[model samples]
Target: MKIAFPYMGTSHIAFKMLIRDLGHEPMVPPKLSKKTLTYGTQHSPEFACLPFKILLGSYLEAIEQGAELIITSGGSGPCRAGYYGVLHQKILQDLGYDTKIIVMESPYRNPFDFLGKIKSVISCSGVSWWTFIKVFYKAWEKLKLLDETEFLSHQIRPFECLRGETTKVFKECLNVIDESQTTEQIREARKLTQELLNNISQDHTRKVLKIGIIGEIYVVLEPFANHDLEVTLGEMGVLTHRSIYLSDWTRESTGYESKKNIIKAASPYINELFGGHGIYSVGHTVLYSQKGFDGVVQLAPFTCIPEIVAKTILAKVSNDFAIPVLTVFLDEQTGKAGLQTRLEAFVDLLGQKRAIQEGVVT
Candidate 1:
C-alpha cells in the first residue's frame, strides 16, 4: 500500500526511509510553497492553525499523486494536533477523496498506544517484527544524522569565510541524506557530509551575534514555514540557535525521555502545560536568557492558542531577565521583505546592546 504523511522539516527524511524500508511506497507531499498554502487554505476552516491548513494542502497533493493510505501524527492535549487526523479525514471525504487515514496516537500521550498503532498499521501491510525494528532504527539514525548536520550548519554559517557556502554544503548533505535508500548508503553519505561541513572554512576571529529561537515546533523546525528565518539571520551574520528540535521530540514521542525538557525548567515561570509547545516556548526563553543569548525570537502562526498564551508569559520573562524577545507570526500572506526588515533591526539592536555591554561602542 502506498502511504503519505505531512512534511515536518527533516523528520520526513527519516520517516520516508522507514516506509520505504518496510516495502511500502512513501509518497511525500511536495514541499510547502505558495501554491500548497493556497490549496490548503482554500479548503480549510478559516480559523485553523497554519500547520493544519498546510497538512490539508499536503494531503491533497499527495493523494493526487496516488497515496492511498494517510499516516498522520496525533496528540492528546488542548492542542488541536490531537484532532488533526479526524478533521483531515473528514475534510478529504467532503472533497470526495476516498483515501484512508490512520491516526497514530502521539507517543507523548501513551507509549503503548503509539506502539500498538504502529504494530497495527504495519501488521496490515504484512511487515515482520524484525523488519519493523530494523527499519525503525535506520529511520532514527537518519534523523540523528540530519539534526547533527543541521547543528553544524548553524554553527558554521555565521563564521564561514564565504557567505552562503555553508548553506550550499549543508543543502548537499541534506539532499544526500534524504535520497539514501540503504543504511550503509546513509552512513557513508553522513560521513562524507560531515567531512565536507568540517572543511568549510570559518573565520574564528569574526564576531557574530548569537540569537535563540524558541517557538511552535512546526514553525521552528520547518524552514519554509518560518520564512527561512534562521538562514536569513545567519546570512546577516547572526548565529541562530533553536531550543526545540525534531530528533529530541521524536525520542520523547516514541516513549523515550527527551534529554532536555524546557517545560520542567520553565515550571518556576509557568506551572501548567497549556498544551503544544506553549510550555517549552516559555522555558526556552528563560533558558536562552541563562545561556547569555543576545536575543530570542519566537515564531508562531496567527491564532495559535498555546503560543498566544506563551507570548503573554514571555513578556514577563523578558522584563525579568532583561532579554529582548521578538515574536513573529506566520500566515499565508506573510511577506518576506517585512520580515527581513524587522530581523535586520533586531540584529542591529542586539549588536548595539552587546557592544554597550563590552564597552566597545560606548
Candidate 2:
C-alpha cells in the first residue's frame, strides 16, 4: 500500500521512514502551498480551523497522486479535532476518493485501541513484530533528532553573524538527517549537524530579544501554517522557544511524559485541561515569563475554543506577571505582509519595554 500523511514540521520525514521500513510505499505529501490551502478551505466547513484546512488540502493532493492509505492523529477532547477523522473520511468519500484512512488515537486514551490500530496497519506489510518494533524505534529516534536539530537552529539563528547562514546550515542538516538510514549513520549525521551549526559565526555580545511561542501545536510547528513566524523572528534577532514540538507532543501522547506535570504548571490559571492545548498554552506562557523572556507570542487558529480560552487568560497572565503577550489569530485570510507588520510592532514593543527595565532609556 502507498501510505500518506500530512506535513507537521519534520514529522513527515520520520513517518516516511517508518512506512517504508514496514514494507509500504510512502507517498509523502508535497509541502503546503496556496493551492493546497485553497482545496482544503473550499471543501472544509466555513468555521473549520486553519490546521484542518491545511491537512485536508494536503490529503487531497496526496490522494490525487494515488495514495492508497492515509494516516492522521485523532483526539478525544471537546476540541473539533476529535471529529477530524470522521469528517475527513466523509469529505473524502463524498469527493469519490476511496483511499483508506487510519486514525492513530492517543494511547493515553485507550491503550488497546492504539495497539490494535498499529497492529492492523503493520499487519498488511507482513513484517515480523520484531522488525516493526525496530523500525518504529529508529523512526522515533530520528524524530527526536530532527526536533533537536531544529531547536538548535532556532537558538543559533538570532546570533549568526551572517544573515541566512544558520538557515542555510539548518536546511543542509535536514537533508543529511533525512538521508541517514542506519543507527550509526544517524549518529554521524547528528555530530556533523552540531558541528556545522556550532561553527556558524555568532556575535555573543548582541542584545537579542527573547520570545516564547505558544499556541495550537500545528501553527506552532508548521512553518507554512504560521507564515514562517520563527524564521521571521530569527532574522530580526529574536531568540524564540516554541512551547510544543513534534517529539515532545509524541512523548506526552505516548505516556512517556507526565501530563500531570504539564497541567500542574497551568493549574493556577486553568485547573482543567480544556480541548486542544489550552492548558499547555497557558502553562508554557507562565513558564516563559518565569524564565525572564522578553515577551511571548500566541498563535491561535481562528475560532479555536481552547486557544480562545487561553487567550482570555493570557491577558491576565501578562498583566499579573508583567510580561508582554501578543496573540495572533490565523486563518486562510491571514497575509504575510500584515503578519510581518504586526510582528515588527510587537518586537518594537518588547524592545522598548526591555530598554525601560534596564534603564537604557527613560
Candidate 3:
C-alpha cells in the first residue's frame, strides 16, 4: 500500500524510512506552507486547533497524490486530539475521499491489541516477524539520534560566532542522518553530527539566555505551526530546551511509563492528568524554573484545553519561582512579525532581570 502521514518536524525522515522498509511506498505530503494551512482551515472546523487543520490539509494533499492509506496517532483524553481520526474520517468521506486511515493509539492501553495491529501491518510485507522487529528497532534508534542532534543544535545555535552557520551545518547533518541505513552508518552519522556541531565557531565570552519551551506537542515540534519559534529563538541568542520529543513520547506510550517523576513534580499544581500534556507541561515548567532557566515559553493552539490549563497554573509557577513565562497561542492566522516582536520583548525582559540581580542595574 502507498502509505502517507502528516509531517511533524524531522519525524518524517524516520517515518518514511519505516514505511519503505516495510515494503510500502511512503507518500509524504508537501512541506507545510500558507497554502497548506489555508486548505486545512477551509475544510476543518473553525474552532479546531492549528495542528488538526494542518494535518487535515496534509491528508487532503496526500490523498490527492494517490495515498492509499493514512496513518495517524490517536489519544484518549479530554483533548480534541483523541477524536481527530474519527472526525477526519467523517470529513474525508463527506468530501468523497475513501482513503483508509490507521490510527495508532497508546499501546499501554491494550498491549495485545496493539501487537495485533502491528502484526496485521507487518503481514503486508511478507517479511518475517524478526525482520519487522529489526526494522522497527532501527527506526527507533534513528529517531533517538535525530532528537539528540536537534537538541544539540538548539544549544549550539545561540553561541555560533557566524550567523546561520549553525543552521547550515545542522541541515547537512540531517541529510547525513536520513541517508544512514545500517546501525554502523547511524553511529558514524552521530559522530560526524557531533563533530560538525563542535566545529561551529562560538563566542564563549557572550552571555546567552536559557529558555525552556513547553506546550502542545504538535505546536512544539512543528516549526511551521510555531512560526519556527525554536530556530528564531536560537538566532536571537537564546538557548532553548523543549520539554517533549517524539522518541520520548513513543517510549512512554509503548508501555515504558517512565514519566512518573514528571507527574510527581506536577503534584503541587495539577496532580491529575487533565487530558493531553497539561500535567507534564506544568511539571516541566517547574523543573525548568528550578534548573535556573531565565524564562519559559509555552506554545499552544488557540483552543487547546490542556495548554490553557497549564497556562493558568504557569502564572502562579512564574510568580512563585521568580521565572518569566510567556504563552503564545497559535492558529492559521498567526503572523510571524507579531510573534517576533513578542519574543524580542520577552528576551529583553529576561536580560534586564538578570542584570538587576547581578547589581549591573539599580
Better of 1 and 3 by TM-score: 3
Question: What global local distance difference test value does model 3 have?
Answer: 0.91
After superposition, candidate 1 runs with Cα above 4 Å error: 108-112, 258-261
Candidate 3 regions with alpha-carbon error over 4 angstroms: none
* Candidate 1 lDDT score at position 248: 83
Clashes (backbone N, CA, C under 3 Å), per candidate, total 0, 0, 0
lDDT of 2 at 330: 93
**Distance from true location, Cα of 228 in model 1, Å:** 0.5
For 1-362, candidate 2 gives per-residue lDDT tens digits of 99999899988889998999999999998778998999999999888999999999999999989899999998767899899988999999999999988899888788899889888888888888899889999999899999999999999999999999999999999999999988788889889999999999999899999999999888889999899899899999999999898888889888788767657778888888798999888888788888999999999999999999999999998998999899999999756898999999999999999999999999
Candidate 2 displacement at residue 241 in angstroms: 0.2
Give candidate 3's TM-score: 0.98
RMSD of 1: 1.6
Clashing pairs in 2: none
What tens-digit string does per-residue lDDT give for candidate 3 at 95-177? 99999777899877887877887777779878778988998999999999999999999999999998889889999989999
Between prediction 1 and prediction 2, the one with superior TM-score is 2
